[model samples]
Target: MSKVKKRIRPTKEQAQELNRRLDAVVEAGHTSNLYCDCDVCQALAEQAKLMGYRTDVTIKRPSDKWDRRKREYERRRQNDAVKMASLAGQGLTSAEIGGKMHRSKSYINKLAKEFEITLATKKRGRKLCH
Candidate 1:
């Protein structure tokens, strides 16, 4: 003969108490059609567990892929700008700098403008004979 285990259930008073706790946390998000797992919800979950009440936790979130990609793109652009400025300061022409970085001279010029970097060899006056 196989033995079946009986499940423990909360008494009526315990049920009411657990319901009150859950209500306090869930009602805050009722207007927005969302339920957050904030501190209040966490406390409610803990209280329900202590009272032997079965609980289900659910969380919903929007996709962050676009936000993450935008952040990464910005970071890379800043790093590239810094590198372009460093190369320009080292007396490398835009074409040489672009070739070294596997980019076009125009793109290097664009980065230079964006970073407000002055090219080292772009003097406007008459050429010196040294």
Candidate 2:
């Protein structure tokens, strides 16, 4: 013989307790939505819907203008890296390049390393005769 399992339902008091907890969560979602419409609040609203409650919360996404500005900034940075690599290939010291580009010598050296460019190093003091 096959055994069948019956489903157990919550009692009246347990149901009331569950409803109170759901209401508390929904209230918290409403408060969070008032401050910021972030992912956490959106998840809470979805949870309320799954628990048989309706919510009017909406999630806000980043604007297209912000994404465009970020992409432009990255493009300019890559162009500058190419320019720095060309300048390094021309046998110019980092200090000289920094002077021409109005950037710090350390900044130029960092970019050169990042772009795998070899820079010219200046020799200091007098050379000894063999």
Candidate 3:
């Protein structure tokens, strides 16, 4: 014969005690939501919710404007473009410029095109100069 096991549930007193422990932590002040998965912890959360305390955590957000941040990033990109142009103008190869700029050769080429810059040689001799 197979026997079935029954689950044990917390008594009302146990539930209230769990609630008091959780409420005390919240009352002492926690800024983030406490994660509860255990039976006692979950029961405590339910109890505090019943006692009128918000168990939900509030998330803080950054105050910076997205538009302003985007503009700043664009300005940084433009500055990178200027640096790349100057480096290329000084006989630096596209690969060298890319290495210095921490970018791929393809990305450097794209940036050069976008900024109306060229990767042509700096001088008329030796058939080469980047």
Give all TM-scores, in the order shown. Answer: 0.44, 0.50, 0.41
Candidate 3 C-alpha lDDT tens digits along 1-130: 8985444565788677765776765665542544435444555556555444534433234556876999998998898898998998887878899899898888888888898887964456575567
lDDT tens digits by residue: candidate 2, 1-115 = 8985443554677557556655765776665444455555656555554444544545456568977999998797688788888888798999998888888999888887877
User: Which pairs clash in the backbone of model 3?
Assistant: none
**Number of clashing residue pairs, candidate 3:** 0
User: Model 1 Cα displacement at 11 (Å)?
Assistant: 63
Q: Between candidates 1 and 3, which one is better according to lDDT?
A: 1
lDDT, candidate 1, 2-118, per-residue tens? 985455777888778778876886676643534456776766667766664534444446578877999998998898888888888789988888888888888888888888887
**Number of the top-ranking candidate, with lDDT as the measure:** 1
Q: Best TM-score goes to which candidate?
A: 2
In angstroms, how far off is 31's CA in candidate 1? 26
Q: Measured by TM-score, how close is model 3 to the native structure?
A: 0.41
Which model is ahead, 2 or 3, in terms of TM-score?
A: 2
lDDT ranking, best first: 1, 2, 3
